[model samples]
Target: MRLTHFRHSCVLVEMSDTRVLFDPGTFSQGFEGLTGLDAIVVTHQHPDHIDPVRIGALVDANPDAQLFADPTTAAARGDRWIAAVPGHDYGIGNLIARAVGGVHAVIHPDMPTIDNTSILLGDEERIGRFYHPGDALFVPDVPVDVLGLPVNAPWCRISETIDFFRAVSPTVAVPIHDELLSPEGAAIYLARLTDMRPDGADLLRWEAEATQEF
Candidate 1:
């Protein structure tokens, strides 16, 4: 599988001859050369997580691509898109996906409308999970190959991120949701990840415009 970090929480995952774009927000870039997107997954309705304008552009570019999102997000699309919920599994071509519930944060208990999810994608032989926690801080029990975790959000403290990393224990933990932070903040957070892991989980940092193959 190939993973490309566009910016902020937006990521493009390519596997099984399919390209799945996750959380194409307003600030995300690097979609100029992308074509034939098989699926688009939106974790929530947050402005930094879902940009209908960009999604419309993507759909216009790839007519066959399907959109999978929660109920609120699907309604925002105003089209006949696929509706997905926690624990639901669906298959598209060679890619199989399972949805898991996630949290928005500890501070926003009143705004539960912003639902979050983690997507697991793979086949029978080898399973690969990409946990896009959206604005969530909860750590799931399931094991994952690659975890796209939010390192710094408005509601998350540095200690909270460390605790999340310790609980999830993913093979490779890539930091996201740190766009508003300074370069020094990111560096410090990365360094903290290096020191906090008890099992020495692989720390992967995604560059704004770079892509990594798993």
Candidate 2:
């Protein structure tokens, strides 16, 4: 599979002549005017994960693209947006997309937690399994090949992130949800994750707008 990192949590996955885009949010770029998308997935209602200002145009451009989002976001968006319920499977071209993680991480005691639907995509044989957990540290029971790891977030600490990484134990770890970090700051997080990574596991540095094979 080939994966392209746009910005922050946005990623484009292409495999078996199918293209799927995830999290076209406010912090993301280079996703505008994209065509031939098989599906567009949003993990939550937050503007950082799904931009209200630009999503309409994106949908307009890809009218045939299947829209998937968290229950709250799907209900509010329209009929075209299907709710990504946990344990349910949706076919996307040659792959199956399954939703997991029902709730977002707790920001604080006073703030209400929202829905976060982390997705797992794989083929029929379950090869090339890729997991993308939007704003949550959801560890799947199944084995994963590639993991989109959120390196920084307000609700989580570095220790928590490390633990989640160890739990998932993917073959490859790709950092996402890192719009808040500077180059040096991101390097710090990456270094720690690399040091604490599972034995023989690889951590990748994906360049924006460039597709890297996993």
Candidate 3:
């Protein structure tokens, strides 16, 4: 599998002869002009996660690609969007995806928790399994070959962030959701991962927009 990180949480996972784009949001933009994607998976409805208007335009541009979203996003987008059902597997082209998680991490006590879904995509032996947990540090129950870790966010602390890696136990960890960080801050977060990642798991170090093969 090949993973390419965009500006923030937006990542393009190329596996099994398929290109799956996750979270093409306001922080990310290159995907809009691309075509022939196998699937576009949105984990939630937050602007940083969904970017409805921009995604809508991308959908219009790439009619052949399938749009999979969590309930809230699917509902708002109407029939065109397919709701990602928890525990249900979706076969789109060469990729098979399973939806995980139900709600976004709460921003604060006063703020209501919003709907969210983390997607695990891969086939029986295709690039192992890759999970992209949108805004939250959701760890899938199954084995993960590559984990899209949210390095920094409002709802997570450095300790909980490390705990997430421990729980999932992915073979390779990749940092995401880092658009808000300065170069120095990102370096600190990367150092934390280096110092505390689970045993035997490799952390891929690549700049944004660079590709890493697993």
Candidate 4:
């Protein structure tokens, strides 16, 4: 699979001639050039994670592309797209996705109402997973190959980020929701992870302009 990181939480996953775009948001770029999108996976309804207008444009461009999002997010759009329920699995083309529930933050315990989700992709064996935790901080029970975590997630401290990595134990960890910091800040965070936990995980500091294969 090929992964391209745009600004903020947006990521483009290419597999088997199908492109799956996750968390299409306002800060994201390069959507204009995307083709053959099998589906769009949205984790929540936050402005940074889900831009309704931009998503509408994407749907307009790719009429055949299905949308998989949380119930609230899907209701907000009020369109004929598929709604992704927590703990349910759905398939689109070669991608199979399962939603894992998580908390957005510790402060507002019940306001968000399970808006965050961790999506699991791939088949039963030799699965390649992509997790977008949104603004959540908990690790699910499932295994993950590539974990997309919010590095400096709003309302959570740096310690929360560290604890999340330790729990998830993914092979490759990519930092997301970090538009407020510089590229060097992301590097420093990864470096600290190396020193703190040598056996922890590999941090994939995604550059907006670069493309990566997993």
Q: Rate the local accuracy (lDDT) of all candidates.
A: 0.76, 0.91, 0.84, 0.74
Better of 1 and 3 by lDDT: 3
Q: Candidate 1 at residue 140, lDDT?
A: 63
**Best lDDT among the predictions, by candidate number:** 2
By TM-score, is 1 or 4 better?
A: 1
| lDDT of each residue in 23-107, candidate 4, tens digit only | 8887777765676788988877777888756777788788888888777778877776667876787877877777777445655
lDDT of 4 at 2: 84
lDDT of 2 by residue, 103-203 (tens): 99998989999999999999878733889999899888889999999999998899999999999999998999988999999999999999998886788
* Candidate No. with top TM-score: 2
Per-prediction tally of clashes: 1, 0, 0, 0
Cα lDDT tens digits for candidate 3, 1-214: 8888876889998887998899998887566687888888899987787676788777877788888999888988886789997778898788789887878987899998988888889886753389998877777767888998888888888898899988888998888888788999999998998799999887777786888888
Candidate 3 off by > 4 Å: 125-128
TM-score of 4: 0.89
RMSD, one per candidate, in order:
1.9, 1.1, 1.5, 2.1
Q: Please give each candidate's TM-score.
A: 0.91, 0.97, 0.95, 0.89
Question: Could you tell which candidate, 3 or 4, scores higher by lDDT?
Answer: 3
lDDT of 2 at 206: 70
Judge candidate 1 at residue 196 and give its lDDT.
Answer: 88
Candidate 1, residue 156: the lDDT equals 85
Scored against the true structure, residue 103 in model 1 reaches a CA lDDT of: 43
